[model samples]
Structures are given as structure tokens and as C-alpha cells.
Target: MRWSRHPRCVSLARAELRTALAGWGLLVLEEAAVLVLSELLTNAGQHARVSPGREIETRFRPVGDGVRIEVHDASTVLPEERRPEYDECGGRGLILVDALTDCWGYGERSGPGKMVWAELRAGSG
Candidate 1:
């Protein structure tokens, strides 16, 4: 799925993820998947240096008893995990993704962008 750089895109992606997982009978992982998707999409919308009309892409695939979620943005910059103070109101997206998913990381895409991905095992909640 592709989304424009808009704030509502996060919730739109989450809703799509829920529908897809439900269709695949993978609702067991829907909550975590949605949360992770939100973070990735939010990052893309906030940070990706794509052109004005460009959009970000997101993919969901099932991989060996787990679901892999990837968000592709038109920026080559990768995300870094930061240790935010207790009073901080942001910067914890990657941290939550790392703790909730089986594994998560970012990679260079074939084109001019980066893909951030995470995997959630079924029933791993």
C-alpha cells in the first residue's frame, strides 16, 4: 500500500493492516502489527525527504509462522533508536517496535529509499 505524507496515513495504514490480517486469519498479531506499522508510517511522514507529490509504501507478508511488515520511504536516511528521558513525549517508536516484534531493522531499497521492517510471530504477544 502507498500513502501520501499525511498525519492520517498512520491510522489508515493500521486499518488496512487489520483488514489484511483478519483476512489471513492472523488477527492474533494484528495489534502489534498495527502499532509497529504506525511507528514506521509516522516516521516516513515526518522524516522522509521525498518530493512533494511522492508517497511512502508499506507491505505485509507472511513468513514462516510470522508476519513481516515493511514500510518503504523515499528517503535513504535510516532510523536510529534513541534513549528518551522519562518526560519525553516522543522518540520511543523504535523502542516499542524492538520490544514487541520478533526482530526489526532497516535496509536500503533497490531504488532511492530505505525500508524499515519488523516481524511478529503468531501468538507471540
Candidate 2:
């Protein structure tokens, strides 16, 4: 599913994750799913620089051995994890996502903008 970068979209992603797991015995992964959503949503809002009325898109797909979550935003800039200052109190969200996800990265889209993606192992089931 895709969503606008609007703030409420974060909650919508969470709800979809919950519904997907309903009675599927995948509930245990809810926190991880939510964390992934939070990090990607924050990235979309912070870096997408999408103008008002423009939209950011998200998609979830079943990969070969896992599930892949991707966030597509209007910005072409790829995400990079930079070390923040010791006194910095923010900007570590992607670091956390990297640690939790089996693999994660960003790539430029064919036409315009970029897509950031993360994957969780399926055998984890």
C-alpha cells in the first residue's frame, strides 16, 4: 500500500501491519514492523522534502525469503547514516533501523526520487 507523507500516514501503516498479522501468528514481530515504519516514515518526512500536496509512497512486498518494506519519496537523495555529535540528541533513527533489520539500503528510482528499503527474515516465523 502507498500513503501520503502526511503525519497520519504513520498510524495508517501501523494499522495495516497489525491487520496483516491478524491470526497469522506473526504478532510477535509487530514491534519490529512498527520500528521499521517509524524509521522510514521519519526519513520520508525529513528528507523527502516533498512539497505540500505531493505524496510519498510506501509498499510492502514478499521477497524471496522475507518481507521487504520500501518507502518511496519525491527526493532523489539517498539515505546515509552519519555519526552525530556526542551532544546531539537526535538523528539516530536509521541507525536503530539498520541494527534491527536483516538488511537495509536506499537506491535511486528510475524516473525520479529514491526508495529506501528494509527487510525482515521470514523464517523468523
Best by TM-score: 1
CA shift of 9, model 1, Å: 1.3
Off by over 4 Å in 1: 123-125
Q: TM-scores, in order shown?
A: 0.94, 0.83
What are the Cα lDDT values of the candidates? 0.89, 0.77
Error of 2 at 119 (Å): 0.3
lDDT of 2 by residue, 1-125 (tens): 77776788889887876676554456666688778978898779777886776677777765555567788887877788877898998888888888878888988865578888988775663
lDDT of 1 by residue, 47-123 (tens): 89779877899999888777899999889888999999999999999999999999999898878889999999995
Error of 1 at 20 (Å): 1.1
